[model samples]
Target: MAKSKKKQQTGPDIRAFFDSMDALASEKGLGKDEIMEIFRGSLITSYQRKYGPDARIEVTLDSETPAIGVSVHKQIVEEVEDPSLEITVAEAKKHREDAAAGEELVIEEEPFAFSRIGATNVRHIFFQRLKEQEREIIYNEFSHKEGELITGQFLRWRDREVVYVDLGRAEGVLPRREQIPRERFHPGDRIKAVIKSVELRREKSRDPGPYILLSRAAPEFVRRLFEQEIPEIYDGVVEIMDIVRDAGFRSKLLVRSNRSDVDPVGACVGIKGVRIQSIVRELGNERIDIVNYSPEPAELIANAISPARVAEVRADSGTKEALVLVPDDQLRLAQGPDNKNVKLAARLTGFRLIVKSLTQFGEEMSSPEARAQLEQLFSPKTEEGAGEDGDYTPLTELPGLSGRLISLLEQSGVKSVEDLVELEPEELEALEGIGKTTATQILKILEDVVSFEEV
Candidate 1:
């Protein structure tokens, strides 16, 4: 009756112990078997620490019975050699009948009591192992997330420099260098950043983390934002060729479409600029220029300089250099603040860009070096004033044409008399900065230079 009463009394305590173990596994994001193995190792360490180091101990945890049982193992010998490892057969038979020499006997260790120090040591080891496992879990989870955009709550800044964000299971560190200079965040605010890297701490410290390093200033951050906000990019209908960023100031992306029906730039911009506006607001209203990818270097360079009209792009395939001519009014705009626009365009297009106005290029053409460059540029193709069959003359080389008219024509994708002749007088007047007088002057210049034959 007393044995039955004692068993009933301790049943709930064992069930409670297993329940807490399950809770710990869930809290630490560890498997139940992993927790049990860690607990078993801790028990062995604590038992060896309390008794002699030579003690042979085994821990058995039964989930079906919801019980934890500890045992001491000993070799049954005719004569005892070591008190901890070997026991006399006479003594072994007391626990197990028919115990023979050279056989091993396992004795159930009931009422397994730990000293105060032993209990503390076991607790420390158990939690430390749990922490290490948790760190590994977090590391594996976030490692694949590198170069991906993630949203987290701003916790606090460490040392007033590094911003710490709580990412649920892990903490992300955004150093001051990776933050956009113009952006600010308050505590408890939701902040979005890209995972720059996953780093493991080597030092034995209180915080054992495979830390997630985050960034808002990286070019990859902008790339990820575009992928997230643009459905075509995500679905592979439109592909991003390259991304370059001056981080909080500006960014440029070169994109192309695989399908003929889809326009890459128009798709990224969305109707009325709704899609790109979301990405811009996410980036703290950073300037974003989505350039259409072109195999022709001249067209690509012209498209790269956006919001600022390009009058002409003369690209040399050999030297990977380009001369970008913009109108006088668009010179400053093309160069952008601190020349970020041109610099980013150069980086994106893989060209050394020399941005110039029409007057500036014309004045430089008077120099011998500029003249030699111009001659070499057109030598293999056609000579000056060579507008014969299947040949074209540059509008700049045409006589009696003002620089403004030449620049306006070039800005409208008309580089030579061949391209100009294709446009009607009405089409010429429809161009920006061109009215009835300018259109009449352009047509008169074309007529005087070329002998037109009626078909």
Candidate 2:
């Protein structure tokens, strides 16, 4: 009578227990079946620790309803060999009517009969497994977001070197080296950064999930911000060729328009500088320059060094070097704060840019060596071979080229056979007066005199 009363008393509590488990599984984004399986294993461990390791125990859980059942299975023998695993026939008959020799008798166990220590062990196992499962879920979810922009709230600082941001399910780590120099953040402040890496750490001392390392200083961070803020770049009307940055100071982007009507720089800057201003505020007022991209090295260098208008750009194709001439009054602006403007421009254009004022260039031009070089450059060449071997032939002497084509080539700085051979077909076609048909004719005529492979 007393056992029947106890069973009735605990029935509601068992149902409530399973109900809470279901709620927790749903809230954690874990499978209900997996959660139940983890608890079942925990129960098994508790039972084995109390009643010899070899004791047979079975745990059953219902999928359709919140119900749990546990049972103990022991073999019936004439005499018990192991008290925990085997039972005598007389004792087994009390639980089962069909108890016999060499047969197993099943006895249902109470929902839980855990001692204090056993209960603690079960709770530890359950939570440890649950936490590990949750960590795995978080790791898998965030791994795909590497190199993407994410907005998170600042949580706190660790060791005065690492900044922690609450990314909802996971915490993002912003190391000191990855942060923009001198940038400050307060708790609960919203911050934006690019996911630099996702790493899974297995050390026992650390948290289980993969570490999401974030960065605000990386060039890619600025690239993602441009993509998000600029409608033309997002929709493919304008393309970003490259980006260079000195974080917290300045960043330069090389952009080009696929359509002739849309100016890449104007689109990025927006009407009265609204769109770019929003990005600037987000970056803590870092200077951003939008430079137009050009295939011509001289034009590209001139465009890259901005804010201080370049008077002229002189480039050497062989050495990949460029000299940028700016107005004497704008020399300080061309160098920028800490000379970062010219440095970033050089990186963006892939040229070693030497910036000089018009006055400085004039002074250099007055030198005897510079004058001699200039004279050699402008002087008309006689019908003389270019190299010592005397095998060099001039482009005018080559057949199949029209007089007009030769004049256009010379006007665009392709004077000799050596200069003509260096230009690709697309580059020739890009010349001011050159057409696709003319470019094709030029390549064919050059092929007859010089084997491109030998050159």
**Candidate whose lDDT is highest:** 1
| lDDT by residue for model 1 (1-455), tens | 00001111247777887899999998888889999899998888777765457879878787768667777778888888678788897887787777788888877654335667767888998988777778888899999988889999999977778898999998899989899986778977999999999977754853457888999999999888888988899999999999998888889999999999999999999999999998899888999999999999999999999979999998987656678899989988898875668878988999867788888888878899878866654455445644343334677777888898888888878888756765667778998889898889888887888643110
Off by over 4 Å in 2: 1-10, 44-58, 63-67, 70-111, 203-208, 368-455
lDDT for position 441 in model 2: 82
* Positional deviation of residue 224's Cα in model 2 after best superposition, in angstroms: 2.6
**Winner by TM-score:** 1
Cα misplacement distance, residue 227 of candidate 1 (Å): 2.4
Estimate every model's Cα lDDT from 0 to 1.
0.81, 0.80
RMSD of every candidate to native, in Å, equals 16.0, 15.2
Per-residue CA lDDT of model 2 for 309-362, tens digit only, reads 989888876556677888988888888864668778888887766678888779
How many pairs of residues collide in each model? 0, 0
